[model samples]
Target: MTTNLPLPQFYSQILSTLQPIFDDTLPLSDPSTQSTLTSALDNLYLIQRMINSLGVFSENESIDEVGEKEIVFMSLNWVIGAAEEKGGLGGRDDRLSALQRAETAYTSYLEILNSYGVLSPEEQAESSAAASGQSSTPKDPAKKREAKIRQYKREKELRENIANSLPNQPESSSSPITFLLCLLPSTSNRPSVISASTGSTSVNQEDPDEVSKSTAILILRLLHTITIASLSSISMEMELLSNAPASIVPLSDRDPREVRREEEDNTWKLDRQPSKYKPRELISGNGRVLRPFTILPSTSDMSDRERLKSGVFKQSWRLPTMTIDEYLEEEQRRGNIITGGGQASYDAPTESELLELAAENDGSALAEEKAEQKRLKDENWARFADENKKGAGNTMNKG
Candidate 1:
C-alpha cells in the first residue's frame, strides 16, 4: 500500500519516523521497530521512484546546472538505506546477494557525486578504475592526505546545504506532517566498523553516505572472508571423513606439523607405553655375584683379600675455556657493538628553508649570522658559475 501523500509530506513523515529509530530511543529489537523501519525503507524507495518519474532530473544533465541537489540528497539517503538493508541481510544466499546490490547502489551514488563535483579527482579516478576492473597507480601520501581532507570538508558542506534546503510545509497550510529535516547522525551514534586490515574503524563518519559506502565495502569483504573460512572448514571435515574409509583409499600423507598437532590433541586417548631406552644398570648386587667388582682394570696387582673401592667424588662439569675478561677481549676484537653510522653523513641544506627561516627571524643575532653566511655562499657560487660556463669542463674536445 502506497503512502498516497504528496512528495514533501511523504518524505517528512518517513524521516520523522526514522529519526528516533536512528537515534536509538526506539529499540531495533522492539516488535514495532521492524514494521516502522521496513515501511520507512519502502517509502524511501517509492520516493525515489516518484522523483525519477517527475523528470526534474534528466539523463546527462549536471546536478549543479539544474539545482537538483535536494532531490539528489533524498536519493543519496535512499541509496544508503538500501545498501544498509542488503548488508544487514543474514545467511549465505543473503550475504552473496548483498554484495552485488551494494556495488550497484554505491557505484551509482558515487557516479552521481562525481558528476556533481563532490568527489575529489583521485576519488573519481579510483571509482572509474574500480568500474573498469583496473588498478589505480600509487599516489603521493601527502597529496592523497590533502585531497582526503578537502573532500571531507566539501562532502560535509554539501550534505548540510542539501539537508537544510529540504522543504517544509507552508505556514498557512495546517498539515500534520512537517519535514523534520533529519540531519546525519552524530559521530557517537554511528556504528564503528573494525577494519579487517588495520583492526580499527577506517572511517568514523557522521555523514550517512560515507558510513553506508564503508559498510557496503566491509560487507562484501566479510562475505569473501566468510566463504573462504567456510570452505576451509568443509575441506578439513572432508579429509577427516576420508580417513574413516581407509581400506578403500589409503590415508594421504599429511604434514608432520599436522600429525603432531593431531597427536597432541588426542594424547588423552593414547595408552601408556614403556620407554625403548633406559639408564645404564647401577652396580647393585645381582644373583650369583659373590662381591662387588670394578668395571675398570686395576693399575697394580692386588691380593684376593683386598678389594677396590670407587671414589665418591668426581667433577662432572667442564672446565672453563677462558675468563670473562678474555671472552670480552675476543668479542671486542670481533666488533661486538656496531659503530660509525651518522658520523659520515648529515642532512645537508639543499633547499630554501634556511633562507626562509632567516627571513622570518631577522631580529635574532643567529638569524643575522645565518643570513650573512648564506649571502657569502651565494656570492661565491655566483662567481664560480660565471667563470666556468656549461661544457667548459670538456677540455679534451677543445684542445
Candidate 2:
C-alpha cells in the first residue's frame, strides 16, 4: 500500500518539475529533457491519484484529471518532436502548435475546477447540511417553482437590458481628399475623375497632403468661418504658405490695363482690339435710324499682352446690330435732324394733253393715242391732193 502525500507537497513537486521546463533558457528542444519532464508530470499525476484514493485529497478532484494530464503531456511531446523535425524552435509553426496545446490544457483544467465542488469551509458545511435530513426542511412546491420562474425571467431581462445599453455608432467623417474635390472649379471639359491605378471612379485618391494644404488655404480665405486658433492648428499640420507680403498688390487691386498687360507677356499672341471697319447708319421713312454695331471690351484700355496671359481675352465680346429706333436715339443725342429734301418725288400732268390722252385711251392707252393722231394727219393730206388732181386734169385737156 502506497503512503499518500499531502496536496501541498504534491503540488510543489509538480511545480518544481514544470518550472525548469517552462524556463526560457531551458533546452526543451532536446528529446532527453522533454522525456524527463514528461516522466516527472506522470509521477505527479500518480501521486495525485494515490492521495485521492486515500481520501487525503479534496473530494472535488475531477475524475478526468488523469486523462487530461496524459493528453497535455503527449501533446507537448508531439510538439517537441515536430519542432525538431522542422529545424528546431525557431520555426513558428512548431512553437504555435505548442502554445495551442498548452492553452487547451490550461483551459480544460480551469473548466474542471469550475465545475467541481472546490468550496471553502463554510460552503462545505452548507453543502453537507443540505445533504443531511437533519437540515432538510420542506417548502411549498408551488412557491419553489414560482421562484425558479422569476429567476429565469430576471436573467432574461438582464441579458436584454445589457444588449439595449450598447450604442449605435455612426460612419466616420468624409476624407479630406473628398472634401477638396468639392472645391475644384466646375468645368464641362474635365474628364470623369478616376484613379488609374485602382480603376476606381472615386476622386478621393487625389493626394491627401495636397488636399489638406489646399483646404487650409481655402479656409484662410474665409477668415470669418473659423477661429484663429483653429486656423493656426490647420496651418501647423498642413504647413501652408504664408500670405504674400503687403508689398505685392493682389491681381484684383491692379488696373484692368495692367492686368491685361501682365497676361499677354508670352511670345505667341494675337491682337486684342476690334476691327477698324465701321458699319454705315441708314435713316428710314419713319424717322428711325439703323446702325451697324459692335460690343466694346469691358476694359477697353487693357493691352493685348495682359488680356492673353490672364485668359481674360479668350471669349470675344458679342456685337448686336442696333434697331432703327435705337439708332435714332443715338442720332438725336448728337443733335442731328431730317431735311425737307429727304421726301420722295411726285409730279402733275398738263390739262389739254390729259383730256386728249384720256379720250384716246384704250386698254392699250398710250398706243391708242399715237394711232389717233396719225389717222387725222392722213385725212387732211388726202383732201388737199384731190383738189390739186382736178385742176391738173382740166389744164391737160386744154393743151
Which lDDT tens digits does candidate 2 get at residues 61-154? 5433433212222122222222222222434443344444433333333232233433334333423433231221126888757744653554
Model 1 C-alpha lDDT per residue in residues 231-311, reported as the tens digit of each score: 333334444544543332213666777777766854332223343322122112232323222233242454444422322
Steric overlap count per candidate:
0, 7
What are the RMSD figures for all models against the true structure? 32.8, 37.4
Model 2 CA RMSD to the hidden true structure, in angstroms:
37.4
Best by lDDT: 1
Error of 2 at 49 (Å): 1.7
